[model samples]
Target: MKNVIFLIIFLFCLNSYSQEFKNITIIKSDKTEIKTLGTFVYEDDLIKGIKTKKNNLLISFQDVNKVFINKETYLVKNYKFKKYLFLKIINGNLSLYKDKKNYYLENNELGLKNIKKDEKRLQFVFKTGEVSLFINKCKAATNELYNKRKSLILSNLKKIINIYNTCDTSSKIQFADEVIKESNRPKEKVKFGLSFGLMKLKTDYNQPFSIEGSDKNFTFVGGKVYIFSNIFQEKLDANLSIDYFFRKNYQINDIDYYIKNSTQFTKLTIGANYTINNISKLITPYFGISGGLLLSSNSSVKLISKYLDLPSRHYTLSNELIYNINVGSYIYLLNQKIDLIFEYQPKINTKLSDSINLHNNSSSFSSLSFKLSYIF
Candidate 1:
C-alpha cells in the first residue's frame, strides 16, 4: 500500500511541471485601415521589430502609425517622419529617398529608411511600401525563431517528465530511513590480548668410545641430558640448548679384556624449528631441519680389556653433525606461552672424517637423538 501511494505521488509531480507556450494573434487597430492594408496578413501573427532613427516612434508589427500606397509611389510613416519608396512592379525596380540618403532595390530584395541626424531612429519603408508597417517577411523570421525555441523547450520538458515519472520513490525513501537509523546507532570499542613465555628440552643418548690398548678395541656407554632453550618464535625460530647428564656407563664385548669408562659428555647445539599443525589446542606436530656444529667435553675411557692391556685417558670430539630429522608432536602443558614437547631427530646421514674402522673404513657415522622440549 505504501509503495503504491509513493508511485502515484511521483507521477503527479512529473505531469504538473510540463511546459506550455502562449499562442499569439495580431489584430489591426481599425477596420477601414485593415481593408486598405489589403488583408494579406492576420493581426495575430508574430512580427520582427526593427530599430529606426527616431527614439520613441520606431517601425514594427504592433506599432506602425500609417500606411500609404499608389501606382508608383509607396509610403510608410511613424509619428514624426515619412519615407518615399518607388517601385515598378512590371520592371522590378525600386528607389528609396529619405532626408539625404538614396538607395536602389530592383529585382534584388531591399527596404528603405528615413534617417534623422540627431535621433537614433529611422522610418523603415520596405519594398512593399505602406504595409511595410506590418513586415510580413520579418514576421516569418520571428515565427521561425519562436518555433525553434519552443521545440527545444518541449523536448527538454518531455525528457524531464519521463525521468521524474519513472523514478523509484519507495527505494529512495527506504535508503533515507536506513541512513537515519544508522546515524542514531551506538559504536562499540575493541580489545586485544598479549602474552609470552620460555621453553626447555631434555634428551637421553648412547655413544661408543675407544681406549688405548695393547690392541685397538672399543667400548660403549649410555648417557642422557636435559636441554633448555633460550628463545622460540613460531614460523621461523632459533634456540640454543645445553645437555645435562643423567646417566653414564661403558661396556665392551668380544675384546677378551675389560675397561671401565665414563660416557659423560656435554653437548651444546643451536637449532631452528618449524611447526606444522596444532591439534586439540594442546598438541602441535612440527617437522624442521637444522645443521650446526656441536662440541662434547669431559669424555674419558677406562681400559676394560686386560688382555689388550690398555690405559685410560681423556679424548675430545668436536664439530660433530647436528643434523637430526624427526617427526614428533608437542603437548602444551601451561598452554599459554610454553609447550611441553617430545621430539626424535634421527641421524639419517653420516660424518665422513670422524668414523673409525680397522679393516674397512666407511665414510659416515649415524646416530639417533631424542629430546623433550619446552617451547616458548
Candidate 2:
C-alpha cells in the first residue's frame, strides 16, 4: 500500500537524522591548551545538568567553553539563558550554532537566535520567543537575505551569517519589528461553554413583576463565551465575557406575597472579568471584578389584585452600566485543554435599567450570583 511505503520512509528519515555525541574534548574559555580527554562515550551519561562526574573527570557544562566530539564541536554560550550545549556547525567571525530546539548565530559582539521552523508556529508570547534575528554589518548581505527572499528559513539564515562573517563593518544584533512585536504580545484565549447558576436577587419584584415566576430568588442557565488574556502582568489577566441567560423560577405560593402579581425580564450582558492567575497549575484561584453595559431588556408584568386585575403587559427597558465583585478559580484537566470554571459574585448593585415606563423610573437592585462553566 502507499500508506505503508510513506510510513517506512518517514521512519527512515527520522533514524537518519538522529545525532550522537559520544566523545568530548573540553577546552577552556580563556584559550588555554589542555590535554586531550579522549574517551567520553554514551556510557558516561551526557547532559547531566550543569555538572557531572564521569570517569574521575568532573565536567561542568557551565564552566567549560568548548567541547569537541571528533570533528563536531559544541560551544557553551550563555547569552540569554544559563550555559547550555550549542553545537557549532559553521565557525568564523560569525558562527552558526544549533541546540535541540533552536538555531543561533554568534559573533564577536552579539549572539542571535532563530527558533526552528516547527518549534513555534502559532504562539503569541512566551518566556523566550521566536524571532527573525538580523545583522546589518553588511548592507548587501542583509538585503540579499531579507529583501530578495524575505524569509526566515534555515538555509537563507546560513547565507546571511556566512556573508556577514566576511563583512568589513561592525556586527550588531537587531531584531526585526515583527519579531519584537510578537515576543511581547499575548493573544486572547477564547472559550465557549454553558453556565447554570442561581441569583439571589434583591429586587422590587414583590409580586407585580415576575417573569417565569421568579421573585426574589431566581435561577439562570446560560450560554457564555469568554476571552481571556494576560494583558499586562503575569499575576493578573484581563478577560471579557458575553452571556445570554434564561432566568426562571418554580414553586410559587400565596403566603410569600402581599398581592398576586408576577414580573419577569430577559437580558443579555457583555462584561469584563479581571482575575488572578497561576496560584497552582491544576487549580488556579482567582478573585476579580466583573463590570458590564446592558444594551436593553424585555420585561412582562402581570398584576392580579382583588381590587384591580391587570393583564400582562410587555415593557422594553433602556441601557445601564453596572459593576460587580466576584471570586473564582479555573480547574484545568486533560493537559489544560479543558477548563472547569467556577465564579461567585457577592451582593452588588444591579441597576435594572434606565427606563421601563413602570412604577419606578429605574430601580436599584442587588444580586448574589454563582456560575459554573465548562470550557472545552
Prediction-by-prediction clash tally? 21, 8
lDDT tens digits, residues 176-216, model 1?
23334545544322212121212122221122333232211
Candidate 1 lDDT score relative to the true structure: 0.35
**Where does candidate 2 stray beyond 4 Å?**
1-186, 205-215, 233-238, 247-264, 293-297, 308-319, 336-363
Residue 189 miss distance in model 1 (angstroms): 26
Best by lDDT: 2
Model 1, C-alpha of 314: deviation from truth (Å): 7.1
Give the clashing residue pairs of candidate 2, or none: 207-261, 209-262, 209-263, 210-262, 210-263, 210-264, 211-263, 211-264
| Least accurate 10 contiguous residues by lDDT in model 2 | 123-132
By TM-score, how accurate is candidate 2?
Answer: 0.39
| Candidate 2 lDDT score at position 134 | 39
Error of 1 at 187 (Å): 30
